[model samples]
Target: MNFLVFVKQVPDTETKIQIAGDGKSIVEDGVNFIVSPYDEIAIEEALLQKEALGGEITVATMGPNRGEAALRTALAMGCDKAVHLEDDAFEGADSYATAKALAAVVKKLNPDLIFLGKQGVGTDNTQVGQMVAEMAGLGHIGMCVKLEIDGDKIRGEREIEGGRETIEVSLPAVVVAQKGLNEPRYPALRGIMQAKRKPIEKLTVADLGLSADEVGAAGSKTEFARLEMPPAREAGKKLEVEPEVAAKEIVAFLKNEAKAL
Candidate 1:
C-alpha cells in the first residue's frame, strides 16, 4: 500500500489575526504557523495505516517557502518523504485551484490512498478534499472518524449531522479525516534529527505542467469582496437583587433584551 497525506501550514489557533492592508488577506507578521490541526490527525492516521500495511507514506503540501516547515514536521512524524509545492504563481489560490494542483500531484504519485484534513484551519473551507477527489476521478469519503483497509477496499465510518455513516470504497480513494480518528504523536528527538536529513522535493506550477492562469488568484472561482473582523462582544450584565427578583429580572431580560424567550 502506498499512502499519501496532504498537509497544510496554518496560523496557530491561538494567534490573533489581522487583516492586511490589501483588505483581502491576513497579515503574516507576528503570526505563528503550525501544521493544520486536522491535517495532523490525517498524518497520524496515515502513519497508522502504513504501520499495519507495511508501506511507505509521503506527505505533500502547497504554500510559500515557509511551508516547508509543515512538511518537515510530517517527516518527523514518520512519513517516508515529502513534497513541497511552492511558487509565486500559487499565491492566493482558492479551494478549486488548490484542489486542481493537488490532483495533478496526486496523478504523478499515484498512491493507493490519499488522506487530507476535512478542512484547512486557515480557510475553514471544507471543499478541497471532495474537489480533489472529483478532479482525480477517485472515490471520496469525508469526515472519516475510523478507517480500515481489507484487500483492495477501504471501510470507513464518517460523522454525519446526528450520527455516523459507514462507507466502503475501492482502492485509489481520497479520505478527509476528521478529529477523533487518532491522537497525533509528538515527534521524537531522534525522529526530528532524522527529518532534518530527509529529502524534500520542491515543485512549481510549470513543473506540474499547469499554467499561471489555471491556478492561484487567476483561477479562483470566487473572490473576497470585503474583509472585516467580527463584532466585539458586549459586556455581560449582572443581577444584584434577591434570588426570586433575579429570576424575574432574567426572564424579563431574556424576553425583552435577548428576545430568546
Candidate 2:
C-alpha cells in the first residue's frame, strides 16, 4: 500500500499576476506561493488511504528551489517524505516535459498507487496525470470524486459532463483527484515542527538520466508568442425614469444596444 502523491506550487489565487519581461513566464517577486488547491485534495485522499491501509505516503514536486516550501507543507500535512526535482534545465517545462520528469521519478520509487490533482491551478493544463500514466505504462482514472481500494483493485467514481461514471482498475494505477473527494486538512503545529526535521531529497535532470534536450523549453511542443492582460471592463449605464417608462426604455435598449430582442 505504498502511496505516492504529486503536488504543485502555484501563486496564491488572490495574487495579481504580472508577466515577465521575457513574455514567457510570470514575475515571481513578491508573489505568494502555495500548494495547488486541487493537489491538497489529492494529499488529503492519500492521507485517508494511508490511515485506513497502514502505508507510508511520499509527496513529490517538480519546480525551482522555491518549490521546496510546497513540499514542506505537504510533509507537515502528514506525508512521510518528500522529493524535490530541481534544475535549471527543467525551467519553462510544459506539461509533456513535466510528465516525463515525474514519470522518471515514479519509476525510481515504484509506488503501488499514484495520486495527483485533476489539473494544476497555475497552468490548468489537465494533461500531466494522463501523460505520466502513459509514460509509466500504468492504468489511470481521472476526475475521481470518490475512491475506494479493495484487495488489489481500486474503484473510483469520476465526474462526467452531466453525470458520474464508476471505474475499476487494478493495483499500480494512477488516480487524478477532482474536487469533492474530501476536505483537505490543515497542518497542525506539532506536525509543522516535525516537518522541519524531515529529509527532502533533491534531484536534477542528469540524476534522472534525462537530457536537457528532452525537457524544459527545448522539449516543449507549444510556445507562447506573447502575453498580455485582458482589456479593462467598460463602465455601466444607469436609467432613471418612471417605472413604466423605464420598462419601455429597457426594452428599447435591449433591442438597439444589447440586441437581445
Candidate 3:
C-alpha cells in the first residue's frame, strides 16, 4: 500500500498576527512559520499506517521556498520522500485553486490512499481536502479521527455532533484527518540526518500540464475582500461591597439589563 500525505506551511499558531496595510492580506513580515498542526496529525497517521502495514509514505505540498521546512518536518516524522509543487503561478491561490493544484499532482502520483489535515491554519477554511477529493473524484472522508487498512479496503471512525461513528470506505480514498487521529512525532536526530538524503521532487506549473488559467489567484473563484482588526475588549470592574448586598445588586442587574437569572 502506498500513502500520499499532503502537508502545508502556515504562520506559527503562537505568532501574533496583524492584517496587511491593504486590509486584504496578512502582514507576514517577521512572522514565524510552522507546519499546519492538523497536517502533522495526518503525517503521523500515515507514518503509523506505514509502520504497521509496511508501505512507502510520500508527502506533498505547494508553497514558497520556506515551505521546505514543513516538508523537512514531515521527513523527520517518517515520510519516505517529498514532492514540492512550486511556481510563481501558485502564489495567492484560494482554497479552490489550491485544491486544483494538489489534485493534479495527486492524480499524477496515483497513490492508493491520500491523506490530508482537516484544515490549514492560515485559511482554516476546511475546504481544500473536500475540494481535492471533488476534483479527483475520489471517495472522500473528512474530519476523520481513525483509519484502518484492510487489504485494499479502508475502515475508519469519524466524529459526530454527539459522539463517534465507525465507517467503511474503499481504497484510493481521500481522508481528511482530525487532531485526535494521532499524536505527531518529533524528529529524531537520526531521522533528521536521514531526511537530508530523502528525495524531494519539485514541480512547476508546466510540469503538471496545467494552464495558467487553471491555477493561482487568477483561477480562484473567491476574492479576499478585506480584513480589519477587532476592537480591544474592556476590563470588568469589581466591588468591595458585602456578598449579600452584591448578590442582590447582581440579581437586579441580570434581570433588568443583562437578561440572565
lDDT of each: 0.93, 0.93, 0.90
Enumerate residue pairs that collide in model 1. Answer: none
Question: In model 2, which range of ten residues has the least summed lDDT?
Answer: 221-230
RMSD list, candidates in order: 1.5, 2.1, 1.9
Report the Cα lDDT for candidate 3: 0.90
Which stretches of candidate 3 lie above 4 Å from their native place?
A: 239-254
Task: Pick the TM-score winner.
Answer: 1
lDDT of 2 by residue, 173-201 (tens): 99999999999999999999999999899
* lDDT (Cα, tens digit) per residue for candidate 1, span 37-97: 9999999999999998899998999999999999999999999999999999988889998
List the candidates' TM-scores in order. 0.95, 0.92, 0.93
Clashing pairs in 3: none
TM-score of predicted structure 1:
0.95
Between prediction 2 and prediction 3, the one with superior TM-score is 3
